[model samples]
Target chain A: EPEVTQTPSHQVTQMGQEVILRCVPISNHLYFYWYRQILGQKVEFLVSFYNNEISEKSEIFDDQFSVERPDGSNFTLKIRSTKLEDSAMYFCASSPPTDTDTQYFGPGTRLTVL
Target chain B: AQKVTQAQTEISVVEKEDVTLDCVYETRDTTYYLFWYKQPPSGELVFLIRRNSFDEQNEISGRYSWNFQKSTSSFNFTITASQVVDSAVYFCALMDYGQNFVFGPGTRLSVLP
Candidate 1:
């Protein structure tokens, strides 16, 4: 089965530096989402994108966070300035237009902000 | 407001023993969706099951079964004859129409051999 895939499975960056986490959702899926889980914490929603635009974003998705579908298959999450708290497992997910309620998640990118 | 609650923080069972993970949700919308995901030691979230509010049917797939009770707003998962591979953290999530998924604090299950 086709699955969501993310790049840079493990990323280490200095605090205050910018970082980009990339994801390639399922080929035909329309909606995309980003979620994060701090170590030992519940996964938190960050943002959702459809038609190349942000459809919904949570409070944690502040100014420092931005998502872009720069190309047909590549969806990227950029953190303007990484903070220690930003260190977490960032997951990308997608759902087909017909089945928006069921999302398929990627393996996740472990971002470690030093 | 939408919320998902997984009351059991952790559970332990010997191999072949059955285990159940509880999930309760609060949502005002008459139409909503519930889901369960598993995250093993590798830290990857694996999709397990999804159920909508309208379908309260109890479903069984192999050794895994799901109980969807809309009256109590609970979606529970049961693993029958669990193996060592069943050891993982399972998450229950709730989502309203046109909204993001609200995940519950996961329940970690340690199936010992």
Candidate 2:
């Protein structure tokens, strides 16, 4: 089955450095999302992207966070000046239609900030 | 704001036994969607079922069953004659058209062989 895929399975960055987490959503899907899960915590929604624009975002997705669909296949989440709390597993998900309400998720990228 | 709660942190059941994972959601929207997902050791979330707020149907697929109750705001899942391979962490999710989603803390189930 076709599924969402993410690059840089694991990343380590300095506290003040920048990091970009990339995802290639399932082709033909219209909606894409980025979610994060702190170690042993619930998965938290960060932002959703559709039609090259952000649909909705949580307060946790503050000024430091940005998402881009620079190409037809790539969806990226960039964190400027990573904080220690940014250490978590970031997941990329996509859904074909909102009617079915099924979003397929990718193998998450583990981001570690030191 | 919407929230999903999975009260049971961990459940232990023997292989060939039946188990249930409970999920309760809080949403103000009359129209929303509830979902069940499984995350095993592979660390990938697997989609299981999706139930809208309007549909209260109880569905069954092989050894897996889901009960969606809008009245109580609960969507529960049951596994029958579970095998050792069924051990994993199960998560329940809720979402709407806007793309924001809420996920429960998850239930860790262990099927002892």
Candidate 3:
């Protein structure tokens, strides 16, 4: 089965620095999403992208965060300025345009802001 | 508002035993989807199963099974004869038809020898 793939499985960065997390969604899927989980907390949604544009975002997705599908095969999440609280595991998911199809998730990028 | 609650924060079971993870959700939308996912130590979210509001049928797929109760607004998962490899965090997600996303809060399960 096809799975979403994320690069740089783990990243340790200094606070106030910028970081870009990348993901390659399934070949034919159109809807993409970004979610994060603090070490012991629930997974939280940040943003959703469709047709190369953001369709929805949560309050947690503030000015510091942005997402881009710069190419047909690559989806990226850019954090302008990282904070210590931003340390968490970031996951990328994608699903077919059909409402009933299941969404495939990547292994996730573990971001640690020190 | 849409919410998914996995009340049991942690569950410990011995090998060869059966375990059930409880998940209760709340959503007013007439059309929605409920899903179960597993995240082992490797931290990869594996899609386990999916069920829609319109289907209340209980489904069993080998060692995994799910019970969907529409009236009670609950979707529960059961694993039979669990092995140590089953140790992982399980998540329940709710997705409304009108929305473009899913809401998840997971339950952690530990299998002992």
Sorted by TM-score, highest first, which candidate order results?
2, 1, 3
Q: How close is candidate 1 to the true structure, as a TM-score?
A: 0.92
lDDT of 3 by residue, A32-106 (tens): 989999998777778888887998888889999999988889999999999999999999999887753677999
**Residues B44-109, candidate 3, lDDT per residue (tens digit)?**
888788788898999999999999988788899999999999999999888787663455568889
Q: What is the interface RMSD of each candidate, in Å?
A: 1.8, 1.9, 2.4
- Lowest summed lDDT over 10 consecutive residues: which window, candidate 3 chain B? B97-106
DockQ of 1: 0.60
| Model 2: lDDT to the true structure | 0.90
List per-prediction Cα lDDT, in the order shown. Answer: 0.93, 0.90, 0.89
Per-residue alpha-carbon lDDT of model 1 for A1-114, expressed as tens digits? 898999999999999999999999999999999999999999888999999899988889999999999989999999999999999999999999998867899999999999
lDDT tens per residue, model 2, B29-91: 888888888888677777788887888979999999998888788999999999988898999
lDDT of 1 at B87: 96
Candidate 1 chain B has its poorest 10 consecutive residues by lDDT at: B93-102
Question: Which model, 2 or 3, shows the larger lDDT?
Answer: 2
Off by over 4 Å in 2: A97-100, B96-100
What tier of docking accuracy does candidate 3 attain? medium
Q: State the displacement of the C-alpha of residue A114, model 1, in Å, after optimal TM-score superposition.
A: 2.0
lDDT of 1: 0.93
Enumerate the candidates' DockQ scores in order: 0.60, 0.66, 0.54
Instruction: Kindly report the docking quality category of candidate 2.
Output: medium
